[model samples]
Target: MELHNVDLNLLVVFDHLLRLRTVSGAAKALGLSQPAVSNALARLRRIFDDDLFVRSAKGMLPTPLAQELAEPVSYALEALQNALNRKVSFDPRHSDRDFRLAMTDIGEIHFIPRLMGTLRELAPGVSVATVRNTAVNLAEEMSQGKVDLAVGHLPELTSEFFQRRLFRQRYVCMFRPGHALDKRTIRLRDFLEADHVVVTAAGTGHARADEILARQGVQRRIRLRVPHFAALADIVASTDLIATVTHKFAERSAKYFGLRYVKHPVDLPEIQINLFWHSRYHRDPANQWLRTQVFDLFSE
Candidate 1:
């Protein structure tokens, strides 16, 4: 409990271990030996009088006490790091920082190509990795530094996160180019009567289209229900199924899939897609750089 008596280096090991959930991973990330990380963890357990993490087949699972300490410990470390490195310049062209992001499949398809193009031209040494937004605890992952940024309309990432609006997106009805409903003007009756490919992109704002329609007593003759947008273009391109998707996604994939999209006949609220990051990283130089690039490149 005495601050002066505790070693600061152990906290670094603890942070890495919590983020990676494995001693070997933590050691590799910290440039230390596995034994050193294990020894640091042992010391941490003795100091806290609790087994902070328990080894299991699933990796080092955090105990309740560790979970309780996660945020404050992470926040303190981030603050300390920012304070210590406030004046250190970040040379993106020379620095090799790996940024992890959380994104949906559509976001990866829509954003990665252009993002990589920009990165290759400016920050060639920097690497980027993406995980599904719904795959992990996004808030906890960002808080612990597992994911650096999450791009999408993720409503659950509020409270502890900071976000900047990127653009307002609306839904569009997409289908094969020569489909019967390909006319410039689409009627609601034709839309509702046609076979639809419903995309259940759960855990994202995109899924609300169906809910909104249902609330208005509008029903589509759904011929298929898919969980992701990755294959929607292919399915809709070959079938008579019309899909309701975000305008950007529909526009981006139309050329490749030989598809056409029209304005949704039924009215629906537009969704705001945003760039999100943990508030603790607000002052971190590298985090600031990455967020600035995303805002500059993607915002309308």
Candidate 2:
């Protein structure tokens, strides 16, 4: 395809289709009629000489060629958007922008409340949405701009993304104030014997706590598993289940939910929570401002 003959608008359609996966979904996302989106997709297919997307039980699955083009197309559209909106300054007080964040339940519990309060004071019209973090293809999701920012202990983050260390957190043992273990400091032996409430957001599989225990040739009996920190904390506060959670979360819950915490028996590694964004948005003025605000709020 000649550069002069290629219609740039098709790139926007392609990006939308890649994200939404269905023609109707893409049309809705782009605010275009289905016929219009279909026409654009047809043009894109002819130019690329690929079907691009094939119908499947799980909606429109992208062909390998489409998958290969996804990131570049998204990046190009983002660049074009930035270029066209170069004069627009992000005035949080007046702008009605929605910032989407990918974070763990712990992050939502400890950070979002304070962050939203700050936003209320500084950027009243701005909104926030949180997506749960999963242990799969996080970099790809960030690259596609499905999430504006991601905050967690993401060991899988690629160097292609830009990241900032938000804060370092230690783990603590949590239980109801009057649980059997409340009167004494927890020991490694006690931890191994007690029933634990494990927060496995991604699923019931390997977790940091389990890995630490495995290193010592000890395993805790996980009586319950939950998907979010909030749920784990709630169960620990109301029941006899003990949970190991970030110190930030434990402390916050202690203050808010009348929960109690004690030092864990084993020396668990300190978890470093970082904020990540796609490199494509690293220099974006609005994103930069928001990132700075988030870092400042959380670091404090």
Candidate 3:
């Protein structure tokens, strides 16, 4: 209970436990073993005079006291980490630091190669790690400095985080070569009649394109639903289901999958792909350098 006796590192373990809600999961996230996480949990319980988290059928359930402690602990840790980061000057060329990013598979497809190419030329000592586990709360991830940059359209990321609209992408419907609808522009009538495959990249069944379609009172028959865009091309190529995807990805499918892409008939709103970072690192020189690299690469 004494502030002087508490190890600041224990707070990090407590924070991860709250976020993941499981000792094993927190251990994996923090790169620690299960025994280590269990020991940390025991220490946290002794410090708080509470069970902190209880094992349940679902997962580790946080006690009321633990719930109360989560926010303030996260904030204090982030602030301290931010102050410490600012004290050291970042030299990209010589600093062997790990730069982490949270991005979707689509963002990996679009950005990683060229970005890494540039990094090799400019900052060879910098290593990159991509985090694809969408289950983690992104706002918490960024605020805690676990993630440096997040790529994609996440409307949920607002207020505390700083966001930059990297680019906007238009929708295109794709089908295999020699399909009945492959030759020309698809009309709204054809679009509605087609059996469609929807890509729910965020695991939210509804997409921005679908919202636009609903506004227009047009409901296409959804035949298949996939979790990622990368899985769509093969499914579309092999099956009769047509998928509406971004033009950039559709172009790749056309060339690699032997599929054909056409403009979607209904006026679908362009999807905004953004880059997000925590405001805590807004003035950090290394973060600023990384931000500049992203903008300069895709600013067009």
Candidate 4:
């Protein structure tokens, strides 16, 4: 493909189609007519010599070739947009950008409230959305722009991504204030013998706590398994079951639930929550500004 012969406008249409995944959806996203968008896609198919996307019951499904082109095209288009929209300084107070983040339930409960408070005061028009974090294929997700930033203890971050350590948190044992265990200092034997509620987001197969217990050849009988940290705190507050959770989350919810936190009996490694983003956005001014806000808010 010769640069002189290729129409740059086609790339814009391709990007819209890639994101919206349907001719009509692409038209809506790009403010073009459906027939016009379909014509552009036809031209793109001829230039690339591939169907690019296939019609499906759900929507237009990208072929392998189109999937391969999606990221580079989106990145290129974003860079062009930034260059064209360049100003001497960025004023978050006036900009209405939406930032999408991937975070665990713990992060949503503990960190987002403070972050949103800052945003509400500074950038009232800005929006924030959170998606659940997954341990599998995180790098690919970040690279594809499906998630703008990933905030959590991301043990699976790739070398290609940039990471900033936000804060370190350790595990703490939580129970209602009047529970029997609250009367005495928690010991390893007592912890092992007590009925517990384990918080498992994905499912109850294996977890960090389980690994720690296996290493010590001591296992606590899990009386129940709950999905969210907030729910676990709620259950622990009203029942005899004990919950081991991140100290930050436990402390944040302690007063609300009338619960008391004690040091976990077994030695557990501190979980370091970090902020991660793809290298492609490392130099983006808007992304940089948002990352700075996150770092400052969490660090403080």
**Better by TM-score, candidate 3 or 2:** 2
Q: Arrange candidates by lDDT, highest first: which order?
A: 1, 3, 4, 2
lDDT of 1 by residue, 1-300 (tens): 788988999988888989999999999999999999999999999999999999899999999999998998899999999999878567899989999989998999988999999999999999999999998988999999889999998888779999999999999889898899998979999998899988888878887777898999998898899888888888888889998889998888777877899999998999999999999888888999999999999999
Tens digits of per-residue lDDT for model 4, 1-300: 786787988999998888888898888888899999999999999999999999999799899999999999899889999999987556799989888888877778877889999999989989998887764466787788767888887677777789898888788888888887895578887888889998776521125765676788878888898766657777887889998887877787676777888888878888777889999888877778888999998863
| lDDT measured at residue 60 in model 2 versus the true structure, 0 to 100 | 88
lDDT of 2 at 206: 27
Name the runs in model 2 displaced over 4 angstroms. 1-88, 203-206
lDDT of each model, Cα atoms only?
0.90, 0.81, 0.84, 0.82
Of 3 and 4, the candidate ahead on TM-score is 4
Query: TM-score for each prediction?
Result: 0.71, 0.68, 0.66, 0.69
lDDT of 2 by residue, 43-119 (tens): 98899999999889898889999999888888888998899887846787888988888876667777788999999
Q: In angstroms, give how far residue 34 of model 3 lies from its true place.
A: 62
Positional deviation of 215 in candidate 2, in angstroms?
3.6
What lDDT does candidate 3 reach at residue 162?
90
User: Superposing all C-alpha atoms, what RMSD in Å does each candidate have to the true structure?
Assistant: 16.2, 16.7, 18.2, 15.4
Alpha-carbon lDDT of model 4: 0.82
Where model 1 places Cα greater than 4 Å from the true spot, the runs are: 1-86
| Each candidate structure's count of clashing pairs | 0, 0, 0, 0
Give the C-alpha miss distance for residue 223 in model 4, angstroms.
Answer: 1.0
